[model samples]
Target: MKNLNRKNAIVMGIGLLMLSVAQIAAHYNPNMPDSYKGFFMGTGLGIMILGLIKNKPKRAS
Candidate 1:
């Protein structure tokens, strides 16, 4: 817990959230809407990317 910095924590959290959603989707009925599934996966990817990439801090020398 203490070892987890802000950026790492955010990324990990988002990754876990995405994973949970994917797991649920995977076990669900195939009758689900493609658009909704796509949207959830896409949004999860986008959020994960934002948390990992956009939240990175610049190195100072």
Candidate 2:
């Protein structure tokens, strides 16, 4: 249980970090291509989903 919690925390932290980086990149590069922005958005969302999955409780048999 403790290990699961720790893994979840790390996953969430990484997702937050990626989101911050994406935001900063968008802010600094106003002329960034749509494809680049789309890629970042997709990646950030994927990380967040992974974090959510990590935090989900396992069913007991």
Candidate 3:
């Protein structure tokens, strides 16, 4: 139902995020400062939090 759809969406979002991170890493310059790493980690964490917030809660039935 709706819960299943929500879960699927979250999974898809996570998958996309992972792919994006992989692509960035592949082309990223090694000499860059650690600030870039911090930014990427922050973005990943923010996405995870967003997914958690969007998830449906279980019914009390």
Among these predictions, the greatest lDDT belongs to 2
What lDDT tens digits, residue by residue, belong to model 1 across residues 19-59?
67865986685777877677777777777766666555568
Residue 35 deviation, candidate 3, in Å?
A: 0.8
Candidate 3: minimum summed lDDT over ten consecutive residues — where?
Answer: 1-10
Predict model 2's lDDT versus the native.
Answer: 0.78
Winning candidate number (TM-score): 2
Winner of 1 and 2 under TM-score: 2
Deviation from truth (RMSD, Å), model 3:
4.5
lDDT value, candidate 3, whole model: 0.65
Tens-digit lDDT track for model 2 on 1-61?
Answer: 3556877777777777777877788889999887787787778778878877768788899
Better of 1 and 2 by lDDT: 2
Pull out the clashing pairs in model 3. none
Model 2 weakest lDDT span, ten residues long: 1-10
**Alpha-carbon TM-score of each model against the true structure:** 0.61, 0.72, 0.50
Instruction: State each model's C-alpha RMSD to the native.
Output: 3.6, 3.0, 4.5
Q: lDDT at 44 for candidate 2?
A: 74
